[model samples]
Target: MDIHFIKENIPLYVEAAGLTVRIALIGILCAFLVGLFCSMIRYLKVPILKGMVQGYIELSRNTPLLIQLYFLYFGLPKIGILFSSEQCAIIGLAFQGGSYMAEAFRSGLESVSKVQKDTGLSLGMTEKQVLQYVVLPQAISTSVPVFCANVIFLIKETSVFSAVALADLMFVTKDLIGIYYKTDEALWMLVIAYLLLLLPISILSSVLERKVRYAGFGNTSTVSGK
Candidate 1:
């Protein structure tokens, strides 16, 4: 373990980590929007869109993120479509994360009782209003823990960004190992960098989950509609 090498390379890893986090944050935000849209389509049972969303979720979830990034970064350029390495990284992360986010959101949506929607409707709320005011709020509250988990998962997935030529933390670590042969030091730094990135999010997720559970958002029983 070369303490001198690790100290000198700290800035390099910091820069790489920053890039990794930025790309992951953007990708996760896009994924949440995509997931929300797809889940809403599924929940509403939209005719053609429901099937399309299901297929997309199946395809995205089943495929590896590396394959997705390869297609975006390498394959697309061959066909006249082009994306920078960063763009490909972001898109691939979002594409992979969206399906999982959709499932999490759909699970939350389904946990809201049909009777809850009906009760809101009975109160003279329109279907839209019922969904907006009654269902979505509770659904989102119920989904918070899952959302936190997904955020962490998506962030970790950024490790694969190296495949597309992004200078993420993993990329820096691998590069250093290849060039300097300081595998142990580079790996230690990688582990420490990832721990710095993930531990807070993990702890925060637990805190959020406990808070959500204590609030009893989705834990109550409701009468089943015949």
Candidate 2:
């Protein structure tokens, strides 16, 4: 309950929080790209690719994220594909989030009517153009809430990177507790920092969900809210 201790360690928390946000943002962006690619492959039903994408989605969905992180951080070195702890943390978080994102996005894509696709074709648009112009926009607008939810989950999961000494907020909080022997102060600061970090994201998610639904893209339950 020492307010002084928490105040003194404010700079450390700020730095740690910055690192955490950086990692989480990078992971979120990468996961979205990965998810988009996965959804496209499955939607297109390319001969060999659809099967591979399905297997990847299933495997990632079923596995523990910790094991996935361990595989990237530890197992890669044995194959000479070395990565630092932070790098592995980013990659693993992105990969683990991507599977869930894939399913969400794929469902969004499919929710767009067959009539929409047919209309795009009747307008003399190429298949690629139809997807780019019609399908992806609606799909993304529809999937925003789910994507935001997954981003929040990914941010929380970044705490696991502490096990690899990635120096994120949770890692720095642990360090503060050990160094100062002030568990209450450090934990309080940790909780506050996370609250500050997550609050705006939650607010924006709600706002965006309403906007997207009102825009006539995501009102259906196919794009379920969290």
User: What do the candidate models score in CA lDDT, each in turn?
Assistant: 0.88, 0.85
Tens digits of lDDT, candidate 2, 133-215: 98888887777788888888888888888877688888887887788788888888889999999999999988888888865
Residue 129 local lDDT, model 2: 99
RMSD of each: 3.3, 1.6
Per-residue error (Å), model 2, residue 62: 1.4
User: For residues 1-226, could you state the per-residue lDDT of candidate 1 as single tens digits?
Assistant: 7899999999999999999889988999999999999999998899998999999999999999999999999999999999999889888888899998898887778888888898999999998999899999888777787788889889988898888888889889989999999999999999999999999999998898777665445453331111
RMSD of 1: 3.3
Alpha-carbon deviation at 179 in model 1, angstroms? 1.7
Tell how far residue 33 is off in model 2, in angstroms.
Answer: 0.6
